[model samples]
Target: MSKARLLLATERRAIVGLAGLYATRMLGLFMVLPVLALNADHLAGATPLLVGLALGIYGLTQAVLQIPFGMLSDRVGRKPIIAAGLGLFLIGSVVAAQADTIAMMIAGRSLQGSGAVAAAIMALLADQTREQVRTAAMATIGLSIGVAFAVAMVLGPLISSHFGLAGVFYFTAMLAVLGLVVLWKLVPPAPRRRGHRDVGIDRGQLKSIIGRTDLWRMDASIFSLHLVLMAIFTAVPFRLVEAGIAEPRHGLVYLGVMGLSFVAMVPLVIVAEKRRKMKLMCLGAIGTITLSLLGLGVAGSGLVALVGWLFAFFTAFNLLEATLPSMISKLAPAGAKGTAMGVYSTSQFLGAFLGGVLGGFLSQQFGLSAVFLGVALLAAGWFVLMLGMTAPKHLSSEVVVLSDEHQGDALETLMARFADVAGVEDVMVVPEERTAYLKVDRSRLDTEALSRLTGVRD
Candidate 1:
């Protein structure tokens, strides 16, 4: 039971390259969020409802296309689907950049989302990396998203202040081009194209995966998290301005809060992983977000209090953002990881869309404080959901190709043999797929012994 370097050089390159690719694109999308509501009035027909629509329209398209894109990648190659998605994103940025009306902006945002590449990207990452280190690789991508959001929050206002709204879209288009370059030059090709149920969507197993109450809980958590996030930003910038922070100086506040929250997030993540207290940490983070939103509802009138609550909000947001995907990877059924992730990603984008619409409507009809209180209720509901989730086991999923001779009665014998191996917890042998999925305690599992018994080379 010794720890060894899990990622090879190729694996390391793929992880970093894909993480950068994800971050670059996400930065483009998020750059408009912080300042858009503030500056949207300049565009033609830019009512509050239209402004919110522009902010959230991307998510609707993204949610619609996420699963199809992943399934397409399974048949076509990963790189091709990803490249096409980026092309759509690039075109959307250009359209949005040139738009004069809010309706046009929404159209561009929808096109931007038509390039739903998240599932394809994750599936490709799973394809290129080994099972043992896959969770860490996924974590790297998740952290990239969190960092991108933080950077975008600050950079959005600064960039928009300098270049105006159209300029921000132009810059976003440039990012899409850069992302294409990374995908082409940096990301390594998958070693071989084979079915990876753990990292890919399986149509046949979709029902089972979605029916799991635990997976539902995780999906709901992400939906709630992003919902609160989008809704808050809908009104937070205006609140900041009313409290005396000018639009141009909004970046400073974001920079400060993000920096401090990131510092706080790292330690909590470490403690959760090392102590195997994921459920506890998850619930606590949700509680923290709820408290932050409650504080915003009550105390957001003051500049200092607004910043204080934001700091707490982002700290919890960052922690949960990094934790949920890893938890999904761990808890998903062996052969349905991709389908599970596809659903998860869809829930996330849908939440973004709903949050924007709801937040804008509330702010327009009720007031800014009403938006905060509404999101606080969402956070509280998520906290209740988290309370019922079972703690995930510290285990990893592995797949082994079965030899032709190991069929029929031999397959049953093989399953029984692997079950006898120490630290092996669950085994499912699918003769049609000619593969075996195993959940094992990696720290104690003997890979060499299992390989010998299964006649599957590592």
Candidate 2:
């Protein structure tokens, strides 16, 4: 099995186009983060609580609609649902741009979030690529998101400074339009697929997925991570302004912090993956976030101190963001990955919603410092929870197509053989699906022999 064979030209096109589409959508959502807090006072009826609601209202809608949108995609085709989602996002952006009141702004943000196409896009990506190369394709999407976040953090303030918050909203609307165009023209059509757990949700497996302690831990980690992220943004801009950094210059701070943090993140990721120190690295990242938040709480009006703490915060954030999804994939059951991810995504959005609301209320009542202290407390709680988590195994799920001839007793024999294969930790053969789900260590697995046994090319 060569790399060229794994990723065909169509697969490459799907990967690049879909990654771009995902990044574009994410940019629209995140571009307001850096400037929203600064501009909130301008909107009519803008109390801290209302401002917080405007910032996080999108997550509430997203959390509510995400699974439903995914289920809808399964019924009416992925493209239609995705196109419709983008349309909803565009409409929301327009509404937000026209909003004069905080309530209207919240409505618009909620509409923007109503376009929940993440699961649909991922399922489409799975349909476009082969299993052997699917992980790489997914990784490309993840990379796109990280890049978009970094770019958005810098661009948000600059755009708002020049054209105002309404202008930023208009820009976001345009991005949504661009996403629709990309979906229609650039992304290839998803081929019909069956029994792919990586692609869509399985209702039957919900109980099992939710019941796993490891999965719950991962879910909680994501929830905590995003909660702190939204909460921090809710207050960080005010601190920057207080520290004498003008709103327009906020991008400079983000550029500096994000650039350095990314540089630091790469080596940590390499060590985590190559050295198999995932749990150690995860704990370290969590600890860093806790300390960074504490520093921000006490740093006061010092620009230098703020920058230093922000640098640490983002470095840890990038590492944790990158590692958590991988951890979920590794920890998920072979045939229930989609269900696990769906739940994980829901938790993440819910956290964003709660974080914004809570941060805003705290800041309003106790001041900006209180918001920082509150988030620090949350991060510390996350750190404590993570301490008891089991270290994730370094394994990849492999699907082997089973022939019709392997039935009943013969299938049982095949399953035994698969389990006996080197580096194969578990094997389950589903006769109804005519596929064998295998958990294997790629580092030690004999791919060639496995391919021979399953009559499939690796």
Candidate 3:
């Protein structure tokens, strides 16, 4: 029978505390988005292009450093690495708060991005929970990020209206300190920490992971998604101003748009997952993004038009953001999920950096409307590429620890047996790790057969 395992008290604490820490850090990062372009005029040496650089400079550093930090945690320990990352974030926030020049702002933001502890944090969560409970823990963290983003969008403009840009940086600094407290005081220490194939990048898997065309398409999807996101923010604040919405009232506008978009997104997400229409939904969302951007380009100067397109843009954006991660999970090989995600994350950040650069360049060279049309063209191309991708089968991973008796030929025979079981898509057994990694179709998986096979003896 399929067994259900509940979380222990410590596990619950670990999940909640870690999710809070993740949310706090993200809140600090995203709060700068809506207000940075609006307030750039106050800084010496600010220009559209430079302002864009300041907007996305952190992504460059984050993309370069996140994987290494996660790998470092394997040697020194997760907590220390997390602490060090948060400290860097604290320092960056302080530097940014004092900045009077765009250059200084860029430097500070880069420091903020240098605190790339996502991989380490996930690894820590993996260590703290049992295999059965880890998925729930990860889901909590993901949900925390989404909530943080929604809150950040609303809070950023309000904070900026009251205390200006410096206050936003100061608030982020406070968030960093709060994250540190949560890390040490709230999250329970793991019994042990080690590299997890399912959760941490496996260097050996990179060649194969990157070699697959479908995975490449998935990576490109994230790249385009984030690129468009960063680029849109570079111009949206200006559009809001043109629409006669004062900077202070921008938060209310965002609050309304975000709330409506989130509500609109839920039913679409249900249709995508429950009805097995992810690919169709993904394509439709991308097409909607294209139409939204074009609509904004054509009519964004007017308030009603701007708000309407903003609603459309965010609805599509949220759907794509949620869908891509689930698709990545479904497409990844049994044991290479961590490596696949690592590459996917790096692509995401790089796209952010490029988005800022290119979006600003386009706006400076042509006009604000050009930025919208240009990104729309990019989305169109993305749609065409996706049309050819093979539909991904719904798949999930599971790990089953093996005993000494299941070694050599016995192990090979058991792996073969696992493949013969219904709904088992793929299986990779690492004798050294004494674990079997399975890619399964849960709707069709035979629970009794899997249980019997996993519990087999000589």
Each prediction's RMSD to truth: 2.5, 1.5, 1.9
**Alpha carbon lDDT of residue 53, candidate 3?**
86
Per-candidate TM-score against the hidden true structure: 0.92, 0.97, 0.97
What shift in Å separates residue 354 of candidate 3 from its native position after superposition? 0.8
lDDT of 1 by residue, 370-413 (tens): 88898898888888877878999987777777766677656678
TM-score, cand. 2: 0.97
Residue 5 C-alpha lDDT in model 2: 50
Error of 1 at 55 (Å): 1.2
lDDT of each: 0.87, 0.89, 0.89
- TM-score between model 3 and native: 0.97
Model 1 regions lying over 4 Å from their true place:
1-9, 130-133, 189-192, 401-409, 430-434, 443-448, 454-458
Question: How many residue pairs clash in all the candidates, one count each?
Answer: 1, 0, 0
Candidate 3 Cα misplacement greater than 4 A, ranges? 1-4, 403-410, 456-458
| Candidate 1 residue-wise lDDT at 43 | 86
Model 2 poorest 10 in a row by lDDT: 403-412
Runs in model 2 lying further than 4 Å from the true structure: 1-5, 404-411
